[model samples]
Target: MGGQTAPLVWGADAEGGAPYVFYHRESGELVGFEVDLARALERRLGRPIVFRQYDFKRLVDGLERGDLDLVMNGLEVTPDRARRVRFTRPYYVFRLQLVVRKGESRCGDLACCVKAAARIGTLENSAASRLLADLGAVALLYDSQVTPFEDLQLGRLDALLLDVPIVRAFLPHWPDLVAVEPPIPGRGFYAIAVRKEDEALAAQLDEALAFLAATGELRAILERWGLWDQGQEELLPPGFSGSLAVSQGSSPPAGASPRRLLTLALLAKAALVTVALSLASMGLAVLTGLGVAVARLYGPGWLQAGALVYVEFFRGVPVLLLLYLLYFGLPAAWAALTGTPGLYISPFWTAVVGLGLTYAAYEAEIYRAALQAIPPTQWEAAASLGLSPKQTFVHVVLPQALRLVLPPSTSDFVALFKDTSLAGTITVVELAKQYQIISTSGADFRVLVEAGLITACLYLFMSVPVGHLARRWERRLASAR
Candidate 1:
């Protein structure tokens, strides 16, 4: 599929699907047979191949929705699947095989083993499961291969069912697994698939595959990892020892940024989420911090003392600790108190409360200083004018106090903006969350640098006008005196 409207392909990380195509999140590189084969085919066809990966069963939905042009995972061209989407002509062929402890390879059926009460584990959607189901055999469906591998090694499962090449690639990493007699009994083929309507693309891919096979490139690529038993005329010597590593945030060779070229929309969504949270947090801080500071400053002694304890406890704690206490712990407590399943507040609102309360301690001190800084003469003058204490505070003390603290208040707003990053630990998709996403999903740690760069730029953008206003307020305070 080469047109602008052409569909993209979806691949799966079938465990031991290793070396055929393994995506290491830390490396961000797509590896193995299908990975390399897809790349080579792009070169052959002179068309770009865009690949998205997920678990195999999940891939079927993308295909049905036309989100995928083809499924490139080592999926069998099964009869049932044929009822759903057209499968290409078979390429590499194999049967479902059972890997058991050495010397116990051939068992008539799981019926004999179950009488002995042995456990067998196979992957969900694997051919081994299909064959076992056909024979009415009992087997465990393992979501990940390592679980079954560990169980079989620890003597929990009697056998592991896997296809031949996967078992082959899987063995060197694990020295103990051995294949026994396979149950499906016949060779099936592995091929890149497209919808039947995509027969044109299939023909184009078939020609490329045939050319690769003829040039001995296919067998050669396999032989490097000892997987080249396909009885071809010639084999290209294995060229490289390993798969490509994906490094997030690291600049690509030159003139290419992963965000721009890979998934710009995902990154932009993260940026917007970050900005929205930061602004909301700052707005709440102004409203709630004023109330918190007033409660601490001028309330009854007991009330002031309690507010003091609240402010001091939060201020003395690390910001990150406060973030968690508010986001997670407080929410749990709220749910318990309310007798509801999910009555906790949102992390954004809670963050504003916690951070606002913490910062309000400093604001309380600022208010106390501002109130005290007003000369007794000024209050006496107001009293001589027949003004009450409330009038004196409102007309004379409060305005000067706000002016005195304008600079620090501005700085505090900036601090709160940056602090919104801690919200990501609760799985909020903020700017910092994007860094973790790109670093883990894109498999590149450079996402940190990328996010940092964007954050610093954003801070400059927001801080400049606010900083200008704070300075202007300072100048006004000087002129007033």
Candidate 2:
């Protein structure tokens, strides 16, 4: 709502990668076609461009929240999107490009790729993903555009379907990869998106676009980026003449009830996965923590030092980094060591082990403190009863320590449940990931809200009961004492 003289704030995801917006390899400067376009728009509009980094999936939400004036990171013009935001005249036209390893022969074209049921990877919630779903091909969705290509090279993905600009920018770096020709049919237009209510801003942006297109400045920018083609010929002449009205013809289908129910069912199923993962991870944490605590407390000096190092190291590193290391780094390291190409662990197990190992460091501290809290009198009493040191520790000290640790352990479990969301980065679609997918593909803002609310409720439903149980146990223990 600032005056016309204020800097125009635009949001984009650099992680979406080159030709759109990414760091240059040599200079490390932020460079892309969109960056150039933003500069041109700034010149035409008489305002400086202020760039803001956003996650690609959440860019629209950022716009809705008034965090950005527009989003220009290769954003596509689609009827569904138009219903939510006003788009300027299309700036660039791109087609989906299919890519496979150089020697791949099973699928030469889109149809052959689909017919072969190739395991294809694409940006999540994208046009290509919807196309793959409609064609019944196995589509793996990723947050970052670059990671999918990495997976393809690692033999984890058979091929990748992405925009032509991305393929063009990245293909050279990957010598073993080649884009399939011709580019997939149908065209998508990239345009700057402004919030639906910003009519004044949208109009101003349209005017700037028209001026850029008319003066041939836009074409020059695209050409410099190697994006200018026949598509721009169709777009430039008619600049800014398009209607702004949201088209009713492209509204979501009448099967809302069924779709909602199915979405709910999928969320519920993902909630179960979250529960199973949390439980398994917590179990491992508890067992590993007890061993570390026992070693630090009672083992030889070398063993105690080792346990201290383990606790300090894991506790210092973030769990998300741990998951990434286990899921992506470990496999790469293993392949380098063994010369085996496909030495990857399943995402679910990788998440389990990563989360388990991370929380164990915290759990060790809790167990160590609880053990120390046990009074010296208890050990003495057990010894007076003719019990051996091991038996005294187990029958007397351990039982009291369990009571002391229960409340904290229960709290840790609840925290661990929420931390499971981080697993999505490694492609384990727990409740949070499921909600993200549903919200992204949903027809309207209402769907985003409803899916979000349901996801939150599911998390509470899983976590609240455990908290209540712990509180009840605390009360019982206080009364008994």
Counting clashing residue pairs in each candidate, in order, gives 13, 0
For residues 106-167, could you state the per-residue lDDT of candidate 2 as single tens digits?
77987888888889999887889888999999899987655677789989999999988777
TM-score of each: 0.48, 0.53
lDDT of 2 at 26: 30
lDDT of 1 at 183: 44
Candidate 2: where is the Cα deviation over 4 Å? 1-3, 238-481
Determine which window of 10 residues in candidate 1 has minimal summed lDDT. Answer: 248-257
Look at candidate 1 and tell me the lDDT of residue 424. Answer: 61
Taken over the whole model, the C-alpha lDDT of each candidate is 0.61, 0.78
The digit string of per-residue lDDT tens for model 1 on 277-383 reads 76666666566656666777678999889777866776689877876676556646766788654535555566666666666666666666666677789889989
lDDT of 2 at 396: 83
TM-score of 1: 0.48
